[model samples]
Target chain A: AAADDLAFHEFEEAANLLAETPDAATTSQSDKLTSQEHVAVVVGSGIGYGAEGEEEDDKTSLLQDEKPQPRFWTFDYYQSFFDVDTSQVLDRIKGSLLPHPGHNFVRHHLRNRPDLYGPFWICATLAFVLAVTGNLTLVLAQRRDPSIHYSPQFHKVTIAGITIYCYAWLVPLALWGFLRWRQGTRERMGLYTFLETVCVYGYSLFVFIPTVVLWLIPVQWLQWLFGALALALSAAGLVFTLWPVVREDTRLVAAALLSIVVLLHALLALGCKLYFFQPLPLDHVVPAPQAIPPSPNVLLPSSVQPMTTF
Target chain B: AEAEDSPGEQEATSSKPLFAGLSDVSISQDIPIEGEITIPSGTRAQECDSSTLNESIRRTIMRDLKAVGRKFMHVLYPRKSNTLLRDWDLWGPLILCVSLALMLQKSSVEGKRDGGSPEFAEVFVIIWFGAVTITLNSKLLGGNISFFQSLCVLGYCVLPLNIAMLICRLLLLAGQGPINFMIRLFVVLVMFAWSVIASTAFLADCQPPNRKALAVYPVFLFYFVVSWMILTFTP
Candidate 1:
């Protein structure tokens, strides 16, 4: 009787400890033990655990055992018993113990390690500089110089128009940059690749624009053909590069169709211009300006003097 | 003895399942004796407290709302849905309508037709012109407009003309020629102004041409004037 009293006192103390503790493992183990004891009671009866006759007997026994197990036993039982919640606790522990999620893990690991981060930024900056400078040079070279001579006013207007038109092309490039930056995950690399392709092509459009405009002005077939071929190759390259990344069939199909149409239009325009308007010097129709006029007059002078000798 | 009796009251208190986690057997067997128990419906084991369930649901709703809010904010504030509309489909119809109106007037005058009365052919011509202009405009500028800007352009440009035309037609039915003509001219000028503003805005930032392209506004005005003369003077 004294031993039983001592056991009961120890059990009460354990129960108090469990209730006060916030650890998930202890609580989960207690639940598992309670469930196991209930199962044992049901199994102990003459009827099978699932048998209808055993259910009533099991219920009666469960009710009798409803008095909470001694706190210490409950805590010990819970701690010893493994169940669903145990798996959850294990998972949490495993996750916390392991490295963090992607990119974040790398970032955290490198937080104090500036040496590791430096190369990445340097490479990125170099790439950015190369891309920007190369594009700007390409754009400047493609622009028609206004100093050449014949239709000076027209040339000035053309230059102005082309400059203004370039703004629209910026939108697509900006969109590509934004998308690439936003979707940084490896799984989304295809999307980023696609955006990059778009950006490259969009910039290429600036080169293409001057060529197309020049072709249109002279209505030259060969220039048109050459332009068309360039366009087709660029488009095909873009599609091929992006095919791996873009998952949507509809978008792929649409892109293909658009490319085909553009190619065909370029081809047809070239053919007609070359075949129909043969040997016409495109430059002859619009003479190159002799020189770029001093800055364009802010307001057309009221005197109405013809500004050019042309 | 008292400790033993304690179990009895507990038994009374919890006649229900203590840990109802896997009570399918007990449910299927014990329920029928209560009276032809159809499968105990909608009985889920409640391991979590009500507060946890409520908190989870609240968190889920808040998460969804936050996501939706972020998307909405992007569209409204930063992305500028309005600009998208203006550059795309919205401007197309307005351009089409104006072009068609001008084209019809030109064709009618070229054909030497009396312009005093409205003819079905003239109406058809107007609509067809409108459609062509819409197509060309869309082709050129569709990528420029945001969805919201398209809506604004449609409201400011297309809707007013339609309303004015409808009102003019109604006035004509009451045999009010002067009033109808005045309304028509007012609507036309307003439409013309809208076109000028829109086109100027569009072209202002356009890249410089390889050659001096004709000033767009003047060209458009000239076309309109020629069409008006043909329609008004041809008999």
Candidate 2:
């Protein structure tokens, strides 16, 4: 399908097609960036997070290029995350265990500005625990079926490598981008703070910690059952943070968004577990209606045929 | 004790970022796009100058990657993309359309095996019809947006559908549950509203004030049909 869309019209040519819109020709404001300038100044200009609130201090590495390069992840580098006003990030940490960190996030940093330092570590920590649990999951699986020799697909080394990047950075970064995009979609423009969303997610992932106990159980169905329940707790945490932000303006919208957020949080957590941790021996992409027959309650259309499970 | 308490008490109006000289927003925002730099022909410099050029190139690539990431963000939120999109490229819309198509295809691969698969052609025809219908309606109602731009906006607006489709598909992994039904209901409903809000927001720049409501009806109906499909077709 994607190949076909590419055949139908290349995206760049489509750009050329619209490269001549009147709006394209003239952007006469200070922020209106020409094609070249867009690349040049986008870094210095804050498009999303507290664009006006922070100052830019260029890190001229060459001033001491000959000087001994400090080991990366040095204290100063870690300190950069807290360079911004952290009363909010601090408040979030204090309120982190609770359901609603958004209030502190909103009051301290506003909805737009969030300190990622604390949230980043919080997520990283959970990701570490998740990595450990993932290795344990294979062990438990093998224990259940002693007669069936199972060569573990995921060694500890590979699992560690993944969690190091995934939980610590990639997941958080993806959430940050998605949140920024969502806030941009909304009228507030800055309503859902970048750090606030990250903070919510960081804490939300905490649900994975207790859910790690799911690894102890060898029963496949039970592990999944526990996984869903565990992820639901994380989802609830996300909603708690999200609720206060949207509730005042639009109750229905807030409720609606909270549901999506919860669902997403749960899905992400579960998906990560299934993909990374639960190395189920039975590997097949069983499309719907193949594995499980439709329940008696499920009334199928006349055209649809139900198939039995494997 | 007094001095320590003083700093804590002075939290009144401190607007500076938490660390002094630490809140430089440019670093993470810089995405590395250029693998390396090519000096202009005949422009040769000493080793030192080249290193600085290398540093500059590195910084530029980072900024470029950030800029590209920002562009993608714009695709997700076209209303915000208004500025980033001036140098319109097919990347954003193509990404969005492909993502939606892939997600729908993934969700309904089962239906395909069983026949009645609304694969690429079916999905494209639906999107094309919806986008055109709204574009025509908008034009009649005095919207100034060009057809291609509407296609671009309308195409990107399906992002919410992609998300909703993912949620629905993921829920199917859990099999039939009464609670699953409710969760799907809530997800599709929000995504429906989100898709509508996004499309309407994108069209706001083009629609006339008096005729805006009329212009939005078809847009709403188009999305309503899409949302209805997402809701009814549970794989």
Candidate 3:
């Protein structure tokens, strides 16, 4: 019933838009400069791209019923586990750089696709890097103390990949959901706009990308410092993209929400540092050298035979 | 092409920034976001074009050899634009299976002339069985893919593992040491990791998320076992 209502509303809106479109088009040529900006914004905010060439017919009865819906995003978008699309993955890497000060790349580029294809895939790949590098750090730590046992997560390839992929997807998703719910909208914003938030959130986490290789530094203090920097950058990138879009009346509410986002990044970076970028012997409770004395009885001469009993 | 050539200055002159008063930020209207630009432009996967399947198998080995080779290399990017997946067929898999069998034949029985070697038999049985088992698992687990499609994807995804095996065989000649052991271990681990990722990219298309993972797990284990074999291979 709601779907039918929505379709009806869409049709009615189209009719009204058609009626207005003629006048809009008549002025549109003169208004092209101003309207171009509006078109980009409309397209950027997830409304479909402005179709050209049929402006006059579209103003009449071109709105027959509905068009071939891309149904681009599944109801869940990237919320589905089975979802995977390489183009979506590539788009996201560009999406992460929404902070770049140039042609409004985010609004321009992201206008292309309506779906969040493989946020999990991007997260998982990064997690895979973190897993391997974390394992490498563990090896370095173990060299410092023979007794240090590595996390069992690295014991199997699939286990580590899935563990990293699943967790990476879950944490960001939870954060995105929290921010959206906090936005005070019950009827979710239009699909494209909603996914832009999701994409921006996923891409901002690319701040953690450096940690994949930086974990090899093997210095505890350096790793901690890098982790903090990554957290700040990731948090800042998100805030920048999200800042303009926050409802004009509720700027304070958005600010409050953003601080929490910063906190989430802190927690994420700390989690990565503790779980993934552990520095050798820095946080663990290692016994002092003096605790175990070199007992003469146990310390036999080089020629003495070793005990064979198990 | 015309739109892409539009002036960057126009975007600068016309568009207001996302935060208008804050800065002079602007976005070009002509920028093509990939999904919108690329996906529709791609050659679509043929839906059960069985009549051409046999002919494609021959062409895959004969005329389409270079294309198949390029697709094998695309395991790295796994881009949606790869025409191999778009024009999905049996030839890619047939070439892969045959070449892989030949590669394993050399590795499994490099020093032995024994015709009835168990390693040869094991490779033969396991490759087909692994492919069939995965197809059945996907079918039973509610995957909406055709049997041949699954077979084709499974075969292509093994390219990395095949490359890893070849690398291992070459590294085995460098004499044993901690460095050699570590390098081999790293390669195997990464290849194992890539196999899981690449396979899931093409093969993970079922519903009821948990079931998809269940179906994928066996493929993961199968690749893991293959990597393990490569890691342990010694002359």
Number of the top candidate by lDDT?
A: 3
lDDT of each: 0.35, 0.51, 0.53
Q: Which predicted model would earn the best TM-score?
A: 3
Residue A126 in candidate 3, Cα distance off native in Å: 1.5
**Candidate with the greatest DockQ versus the true structure:** 3
Q: Which sections of candidate 2 miss by over 4 Å?
A: A1-78, A82-94, A100-115, A155-190, A219-229, A248-256, A276-279, A282-310, B1-235
State the displacement of the C-alpha of residue B194, model 2, in Å, after optimal TM-score superposition: 55
Q: Write the per-residue lDDT of candidate 1 for residues A5-64, one digit (tens) a residue.
A: 986775554444333322211232234456444434433442232343334434543533
DockQ winner between candidates 2 and 3: 3
After superposing candidate 3 on the true structure, give the runs of residues whose Cα lies further than 4 Å from its correct spot: A1-66, A70-92, A98-106, A142-192, A247-251, A279-310, B1-147, B156-176, B182-235
Task: Give the Å shift of residue A106 in candidate 3.
Answer: 4.8
Q: Given candidate 2, what's the lDDT at residue B113?
A: 54
All DockQ scores? 0.01, 0.01, 0.02
**Per-candidate TM vs. native?**
0.20, 0.32, 0.44
Chain A accuracy as TM-score for every candidate: 0.26, 0.49, 0.53
lDDT of model 3 at residue B27?
43
